[model samples]
Target: MGGPVERPVPEDSAPEQSAADVAPVTVGQGSVDSPSGVERHGMFGVAGSGDTSGFGGLVREPWTAPGAQRPYGSYFDEIVDGLYEAYADAAAAITKVVVERNELTLHIAREHLIGVATALRNDPSLRFELCSSVSGVDYLGSTHRLHSVAHLTSMTYRRRVRLEVSVSVDDPHLPSLTGLYPGTDWQERETYDMFGIIYDGHPSLTRILMPDDWDGHPQRKDYPLGGVPIQYKGATIPPPDERRAYK
Candidate 1:
């Protein structure tokens, strides 16, 4: 069995200390079905009415994803080193390196995405042969609100790594990985369709799930919840936005 890998401590950072001295970083928050904040009674243009649901008193606090500490054991060290050696020129493009839950995640800048992907695949030491999935996330309160995530697997080493790139919602374009991994075509499109993230070099980035005539990305946090009326069993129901929900 391989011994635990020791990570290189940054010279500029503080001296290495016990794990107890390090504060844990928050990663993700509430799930899509149950987000953190409660929708106000009248905030969505409904008439002013007191909420009767017991959840009305609920309040949510914002939490940011924090970077993880090093000594990221197992094969994480080898993978990071291989990537650094393979793409020396793009070294500066890396923003953060996180190893958590026995997984390695590389936070890369948008401009260097293609180069990084190429190196991750072609580099002999880091033969990440498969680009497993492409997905997107909307960090509602983050400065760079949109995040594109790619999962890569190295069959030879039986290892997996995640590449993440963030972009502001205003300028939501990132270079496409279709050139490297053809399977990402539909996945990227779906992510774009749902999150409004544009893959710059995508051959045809039309909506995969939503209709072409859809007005807006439905998955965005700020998107209107409900306005259209629903009819079932000859009964009319207000749109989700207009309905009385937890405040």
Candidate 2:
């Protein structure tokens, strides 16, 4: 048919701004759309000042991971092939596969976590026996703000792989891996305690590090850093907000 579409690139003469100089950007509501259809929200650099420092010319673009191409090299290819063959019925669950820094990470859909995990552990060819760790990450700006990471280890093959699942903060529910790996019991609790991700089938999912009445998930980026002021030897020490601060 026709030739491929070409996109225009910004000129070098255009001003740039550093990430630190950029204000927090909210998407979709008031964001400005570029000619290429990418949304640009929030201003960078000093609002009303002229650039004198070299860093003032730096602009920050959105962060995204590039797709990895096959042959993925080494055992990564075998693992993917095995997984695909084993979970052929649930193919949609495996969203993306990434190979970075000699590691393989599978970005899985939240709803398919349990099924994928089960397949990884039981399939003879892909015997990922151990669920080493479970952790959480809050991607501050994206639509899927909460991410749960599960590190899997194959004791039989001496290999490791990571499984990642992303969900919206509004409905942070994931299928608990406790049924597949009992060690994940406490780890899941700890993640829920700090990141507010609710593992639906976790047994006794409660505060592991924080007190039972803790107000918020402490590790989330949007969580407040300071709480009530500390009292030392009957003297009042103000909370972080009341103390002197520097930008």
Q: lDDT tens digits, residues 105-222, model 2?
A: 8877765677677777777777787999999887777666778899999876777999987766777877788878889999999999999998876779999999999999998877
Model 2 residue pairs with clashes: 16-57, 16-58, 17-58, 17-59
Candidate 2 CA-lDDT value = 0.70
- Candidate 1: which pairs clash? none
Q: What is the lDDT of residue 61 in candidate 1?
A: 58
| Residue runs of model 1 more than 4 Å from their true location after superposition | 1-59, 227-247
lDDT of 1 by residue, 1-247 (tens): 1432333423542212222332222233221111224333232343545653434445445554456656668988788888888887555556777777788988877667777777787776777779999998787766567788999998767789999877767778778888778789999999999999988778899998988999888888788776554676766666675575433
TM-score of each: 0.72, 0.72
